[model samples]
Target: MTLKVERLGHSTRLQEVSFAAQPGELVGILGANGAGKSTLLQLLCGVLEPDAGQLTYQQRDLTQISAYERRQLLGYLPQTPVAEGGIRVDHFLQAGLVNLHLSCPGKELNRVVETLQIHALLERTLDKLSGGEQRRVHIARALLGDHNWLLCDEPTTSLDLYYQLQVMAVLRAQADRGKLVTLALHDLGLAARYCDRLVLIDKGRLLAEGAPAAVLTDANLAQAYKIKARWLCTDEGVTLLPSLLS
Candidate 1:
């Protein structure tokens, strides 16, 4: 069964936002700062209890599910992931397995390390790594298990463009391999190119939800961001030019 949200609300941060995502689709949550993208993701991963509405996945009602069951169903990466600065990368990743109660730590660890290309950094401590490297490790931790549903808040934030595309590509590949991956991303270009569908949130409400070309239109940009922007469209995909922001 697909992941479904019906009239979901959380205080004033989010209100009556509803959407559905299926396995094999990468969904991007697009919104301005404080537009409830992060809040919506929290409800998806059970970080916050909804003050209203329903959340269900795989024929199970997530709103009423046990913590253990929720753990089994969702894997999450917070907007600002934290770890002991002194902890070694290996141990840090291993801890995620322990926390999530995952099996075959060695196998799982190797898989994520390989996918994220972080094998060489395994012996380094968290404080020693650069921002991009730390973000990669955090993503690896969130991806420890074979979760069908994954939620991440701004997985590409604060990284250089290279890392941004790398991380988004990894998540997109995961979705192609049959996982419902959702992430809140500020980069419209990344979201347009990598996400199978987009949910445009504005002022804690759903402004639009559809294909990239449909959601990232001139009208939506003006309404959601209050800016005049340009889209460079090509055979490959759409790319939003920040220079055109006015």
Candidate 2:
């Protein structure tokens, strides 16, 4: 089944943005700050309603689904860490599965903890961890469920380069395993390297949508980010290295 947004719009933010993504694809949403990336994610997850268009999954109207069903379909990770209390990480992760009423909560916890490499942080209190560590914990919790779509907003924000790559890899692996993974990223290099497809939104409109190589062009970079960027081709994929605006 494919998830699609048709003519998605919000009066002040987005304007007739349209796109579609299917399972097993890592889709990246890229744009300048306040370019409606977060708003787009929120609309997809039903956190905000589009005043002008529709969100559909496999031809079913998403706006008509119940809250519980919507929860089962989408897992969202906000840009800021939402769990800041002093709860133990293990308990926190377990609560995520429990809230979903999973039949095998323990199994889910083990899967996420191992996949995210957060075994060491499992026993620590949430508030005691650094910002990056907390981000890892949140990511693990978000991954605890078997949701079809994972919408992440800047999941790599506070991480060092190592952890940033680590998190991105886990997300990519999720896409490989037949889940639709979409994330908002500021790192053009990472977005181009890890994402299978890119949705470049410039000033609240979709400027381009296609493979990373097709979307991250020099003109797109200058128009969206106001910078002259060079695309470096590598064996892995293309990477955008931005230089000063001409």
Candidate 3:
């Protein structure tokens, strides 16, 4: 699945921004606060409609499709996910899969739960889990159905170092399996490590889009973020090493 956004616009913020992502690609959107990253994700998820331009999925206009059909092909994780009802974690996940009409049985559910390391909290109420834990459950639910596209906003927020890497690892695995995963990330280092592509936006406008190493250069960081940062590449991955701003 590939996505094309041309001249996409919101009411007050983003304007005429465009980008594209191919299948099995992990595209990370990097920007400072209020960069319209969340808005872009919401638009792509069909939660909000663009006033102008075209959103195409596989060369088909998304606005022409039914809301239900558009949702069935996309999975979205917002910046802040609020869990509803007094449902237990496992029950919520089950309901999510049911709503998507996925064919996953008990075994698959167990595997996903275990992979996220949330098996122990399955029986717990959603409200009982920590913020990070709840975020993990939300991720598991978003990934429950076999959706082709994932639009995640700030996926690593509230997660500790361990779980942060873990979440990125899971996202990378999803991309490897031919899913188009787009994430709005604050952590540039993590983005470089896991994301196959990067889209940089500033003040509701697209600044750059390409490989992390190229798009996340010292000059680009300074230009978009107004902060001096050094770029280092190793066999492991690219690193955004920053010095004290003067």
Candidate 4:
């Protein structure tokens, strides 16, 4: 799956932004608040149509696809998961898989639960779970259904260090399995360590896109977040360290 955005817009925040992500790749959208990160994810998920641009899947016009069909292929985790009804974890996940209409009554649910490390909370009510647990459960629900593309916005927004790392690991594993994972992350270090590629956005425009070492440079980081940072490359991969701003 490749996403192409040409002259896309919404109100005054997001302007004509364009970019693409190949299959099995993890692309992180990096920027500060109000930089249109969330808006861009919404556009990719087809929740909001581009005011003036093209959004296609496999070289075919996506606009022609119905909403139901789009839901079948796209899995979205918004900044805040919808906390509706006193639904139980197992039931919520079951609801999410209704669209696929496939046969995953037991194995798939257990896989996601184990993958996200939420097996203990399976029987608990959603409203009773902790924030981090809820995040993991929401992700499980999104992954329960059959979807090829994942659009996650600030997935680890409100979680402790442990849960944050766990979420990142889950996404990384999905990417390794040849699935497209696009995420918006504020933690530059987390993005650098986990994502395969980076898409830097500033005020609704794409500033840079490439490997972490290439895009998370001091100059680009400063321009995007108004901060100074150094990129250190080791055999492991690129690491970002914040430098004195003044």
- Per-residue lDDT of model 1, residues 128-223, tens digit only: 999888988898888988788889999986677787878888998889899999999998988889999999999999999989889988889888
User: CA lDDT of each candidate?
Assistant: 0.87, 0.87, 0.85, 0.82
Which residue pairs come into collision in candidate 3?
none
Instruction: Give me the runs in candidate 4 sitting further than 4 Å from their true place.
Output: 231-239
Candidate 1, run of 10 with poorest lDDT: 237-246
Residue-level lDDT tens digits of model 3 in 101-205: 656557668867877889888999988888898899888877766688888999888899899989999999999999999999988999989989999988988
Candidate 3 residue runs with Cα over 4 Å from true position: none
TM-score of each: 0.94, 0.95, 0.93, 0.92
Model 1 clashes, total count? 0
Root-mean-square deviation per candidate: 1.7, 1.4, 1.7, 1.9
Top-scoring candidate (TM-score): 2
Q: Single out the weakest 10-residue window by summed lDDT for candidate 2.
A: 94-103
Query: Over the stretch 1-246, how does candidate 2's per-residue lDDT look in tens digits?
Result: 887888889976898888888999999999999999999988887878889888898788988988888777778898875655989999888778755867877888898889889999989999899989999889888887878889999999889989998999899888989999999999999998899999999888999999988998878888999999877887876676688785
Better model by lDDT: candidate 2 vs candidate 4:
2
Error of 4 at 121 (Å): 0.8
